[model samples]
Target chain A: MSTPLPDPSSEQLPFEPRRPVADADRQRQSWNAIEARLQEAPVKKLPIAGWGRWWWAAAAVLLLLAAGAWWWQGRSGAGSATSYDLAYKTISTRFGEKRRILLPDSSVVILNSNSELKLPADWLLDTLRQVWLRGEAYFEISKSKQPGVDYFLVHTDRLDVKVLGTKFNVNAYTAQTTVALKEGRVELLYSQRPGRSAAGLRVHSMKPGDVVTVDEGPVLTPMLATAPPDVMADWTSNEYHFDYTSLAEIGRMIEQRYGYEMEFETAALADRTMSGHLRADNLDQLLQALQITLNIKIEKKDQLLKVSVP
Target chain B: MTTGAMPSPDLQNAWDRVLAGHADGLRQIHEALYASMIDYACRLLQDEMLAEDAIQDVFVKAWQLRAQIGEVQSVRAYFFIMLRRHVLNVLRSRQSRRRQQQQWQQQVELDPVFSAEDIRVQAEHTRQQQQKIATAVNELPARQREVIWLKYYAGMEYQQIAAVMEINYQSVVNLAFKATQYLRKRLSG
Candidate 1:
């Protein structure tokens, strides 16, 4: 068989016409198709009369006013609103205090110090199976056999975690959201809010042994770490363990944990790694041990703790 | 076609005619705009089924707010905007759902053959030679594509295209010129 040759003048070829689309005929077909599909789609009768119209108008007016206010405030400023429904629950723990929460679904949440989580009471609803958390939390999501219904979602400000009958730990505080999968597979979505529309929302997914962070914007860079089981659970049990945690990150963690301020003196020392386990109550002793082992001096002035090489 | 039946002109004039509290004017607006709105939505979403769904939503929403819709400057633009918003909402929710199940690595690789640049280049050449110029029209740069769609498909003016695309009049002129030039080159070649 002879191969069909490419047309050399294909680029020069004028537009080709097959048949005209009769708008009237196509419209009739489209109307029929729309009717059939509408029958299948869930239709929520939005009553425009009575209180509903007023409510909607009020909402629209409020939104317009808010938009006007936002423009006046500064068009480019970050604006966020937090709304919670009746089916959701929010738990916040102060610094140095750990809290345990049992969700409306069978999932268990162990919120570490200075952490908070908002989760829906029922995961069976098609629209409301998601959860949002800040700081750190260990989740043991209950398993469900319903094919597509079994999903546990955790949303931080920047990261979104999706799990199907798995255990994972998410440490997503102010700047970063990190996920460590201990069992099964967990999907992590790192979203960067693009400054420009062309960039859109940059998203990345992560799997087991993958720790992904969604920082302030839409860049998702992953770091590899051993999938240690129940590392987050230890925090709730008054134990903190770090396997090669960086000095800078450790310093930040210390600040968050104790509600004290800490800073590294030099950039080189910030990269220094530490590995140890210490009771949550013995942070002072742990800091002393770190100073001795790392050959550094720890200075305290009011609320600030400074670490420096002597 | 009965003589006693309400004349099309009378029916058209019966904007205030309320049939069981439903405005006849609104019904006529939906009837006039529904098909075009669906076509526009389908082009934006590139999904026939989704476009149909969005049109249904638009009709429901229009019916519910029939009173307020009278204030709309252009019913066509209003309906198209509604459909556009609905399609974007659907796309965003779908993206969120897809992000949950799919691996990040698998999803990041841009489709080699169907990249935006390739489509734009191919469209530029093919659009010039076509009799039915609309299909090739969608291949232009987003601004030009939108301008042509509004100008030819919707029978809108340059000023209207400027308003719809949220661009200045000069920019619209430049885009249309550039688009026409590409078409001319392809046709003359």
Candidate 2:
């Protein structure tokens, strides 16, 4: 009595119509068990190759800049950092650019976009391994150089993070400074200058996974390390994470990471937030991704960008 | 430029978080899609345990290589593709090992999860037609079964199937069309 099946071109499939309800429960249990095992595994970090040879040149440049700044401060950080800009170098990445430097002591540093690291010329000559950082950088410092146990010190504007040798990330933008220790040990020393005594520089030891933030004020005060280390998030890899973050903040990030000046018509629009993971090869690609996904409009005029809400 | 919006996981927020490599996202994706992937794997491997193993292997590899792989055009399809490769490799290795040991037995039978009985009810005549269509499909070759599942069960477009199968666009359409013609021939015969 049946003539024939409907034409397949219509995209009709007579496959199993009914799905078992009990299978859902079984699936949930299986997945839960797997998730538990995954949770027990150690956190994974990206593998960094050797880039130690070029650090001295970059550190030297940065040290010169730091010395110039220190001298301008009129002997404020006096007797602490002497002439070390000869072999030392300074390395920096402009907006949308990142650089990697290899320290004289063989420590590896990755300077984030719009970040700078300054090293003195006499870096290996002195007892202290010192560097000045602005913006963000991740360091894999070598603790020992065969015979001698080298001391490492990273001075941001507000605080100084010292470690013999360890892996950590430092974020020292204008707003605040944060240090996250991924491995080994680090000591945070707040630098109290101006009218405050040097004793104000309290030393706080940090363990792995420990993160501390130093706020910007007339005095440097350490905030409680409550929140997890979002500062240590890898931006260079594959994905960008934003959690209800404001458009203004996102714009600033894009500006830093892609060298784009993003503008909004209204302050409210600029403050609008979106949460998603964005993947793009470059700044233009990232902007296109955001626009395509968020149902927003973006127009680029020369070097300026105007993002409009739909 | 796979800008064409592909299907996202039901949990969009969780998917985005997974893309970001957050711990929460990892758990969410595992919970949300693991069962589906395992079921899909089971169709190929037949044994529930082996299917589960294959899926776990794929998921672990996916996680480890997530950063390097970058963003996926379609998360579901990507996972499915990974699972397919893993199961096939496992089958191949087992076959070779069995060959070396000379203990080879019968090939594993893929359970016929897709059947005419799954179609929605209609008139008596339509029901018969649906059953005939389902039977024809179940009888298709291994490659045809794959394209059928990807197109119908996974709801992947022709382009997606082509990309996942590593074939050209025309090849994908031709495969599907050929499968359809084969199904018609079987039903009519």
Candidate 3:
């Protein structure tokens, strides 16, 4: 295969003919193919009568004025109206809440607390099954038997999880996004910056029992041997297991699950580690268990939970 | 055919005629963009007949919506955008219908030869084959391939490419740069 560096000055491509010449036969065939459809729908013409033309012209003038003003506004707003933000429908869960959503394609998403999922509003019309995720979510994506429609994409701020009908848990609430696949296959695509161009993008395929965490930089750690996939997804069963996890990390999880402002007496206390299982479903039970396990005093003033060594 | 670096005055005049409800004007626009549009759709859909159908749909829809299309900055960009959207929607619906039919067949007939696993593997194979462009360009991701196509082959600026691809302009610029760098390195190596 011949690969020539593309020349900006030239109009032709290196790999294939940039534009195949439209020979007479092909052009005629194309014209004949579309001529019938084109004729079926001619441009609708407004009826021009004596007084109606004047009214129509006045209405057209007003319409043009409004359109011009809108055009100016759109230009000033940097084309926000035409941007992709309007194309999505967002579903969010509040703190201490979990919601189950059924996508248009019959896929199931179990949204964890304080997470948001932005699904394309026009899913049926779109060629891509793409959804934006903020925070953690467990997904059981329905597999597509068709060729072009099989790819499902889950986009986070740090990574994109591409899968073909896989069961996986994604935690994107923090700076680092972790993806643990329970069943089927998944491909993690990420760049140094989320939604960056394909240049910095990296793709890593994950099979069942695979766990990968992606940070803001080039730190991608695949911890399949260290962490069990079942432990990763056990949160769905209301089980919290920590193996030598730092108190700072546990504080973040408590904040997300209960909407509390966590405070430690000192930096050392925040860095203190714990290893145990806390199966409490509610905040009080979890806090009681924490106090009993760590020999610490907990003071709750409204929504703030402060920890201090007694 | 022009590479569409600049929107031609001829296309602008043809678009004006189209807005004025002239079928011949629409014919002119169609004839001018036929080859490039077909090539683009064929590359994306990989089926000439479907590509032709998609082009026909674009023209018919363009004529139908001419009154509402108003004055676009570039008639070439408008048509390409319309063609791209129509082709994707067609592929999505066609594939969706095929999927429903497959599920129905599974429930009713349960053919051992055409099992669900066979179809899944075949679908996976087709996806791999789609990525096999048989050139250094094949190494680029799907989105990068689009950026390369629009920048090099379609002769579109970053802004126009961004509009058609529904991404931001900066992304298109970065993608083009990344793709060019990759292609140059691969070719040189």
Q: Fraction of true inter-chain Cα contacts (below 8 Å) kept per model?
A: 0.08, 0.13, 0.47
Q: For candidate 1, what is the interface RMSD?
A: 11.7
Candidate 2, residues B19-128: lDDT per residue as tens digits?
Answer: 68775776666666665566567667654445655665666666666677676776666776777777777677556544544554657444335555444334464867
lDDT of 2 by residue, A1-310 (tens): 3122223345332111232212554555555545555644544644323454355456555654555365133222211111212344445565655555666566887777667677753543323578888778889899664335356888776777888788888888664778888788889887565433586657889888787887767777777553344434455453577778887887877765556688897777787778866655456566766776666777776556788886
Which run of 10 residues does model 2 chain A get worst, by summed lDDT? A75-84
Collision count of model 2: 20
Off by over 4 Å in 3: A1-86, A192-195, A217-225, B1-189
- In the range A225-277, model 1's lDDT, one tens digit per residue, is 55556554466555667889888888788777667677778888899987877
Per-residue lDDT of B82 in model 2: 79
How does each model score on TM-score?
Answer: 0.41, 0.43, 0.46
| C-alpha lDDT of all candidate models, in order | 0.56, 0.64, 0.67
Residues B66-143, candidate 1: write the lDDT tens digits: 466554455455565666667667666555544544513222211101122212333454533343344345456666
**Leading candidate by TM-score:** 3
Best by DockQ: 3
Predicted candidate 3 versus true structure: per-residue lDDT over B69-97, tens digit per residue: 98888787798899888777766655654
- lDDT string, candidate 3, A1-310, tens digits: 3122232334321111122324455666667656766657465746545785476456444433442222123112211011123244556666766666666576888777777776654454225677777779999999875567688888776677899998999989876778888888999887643335577777889878877876645555434433676677666766788899887888889887567888999888888888976676556656777777877767776777888997
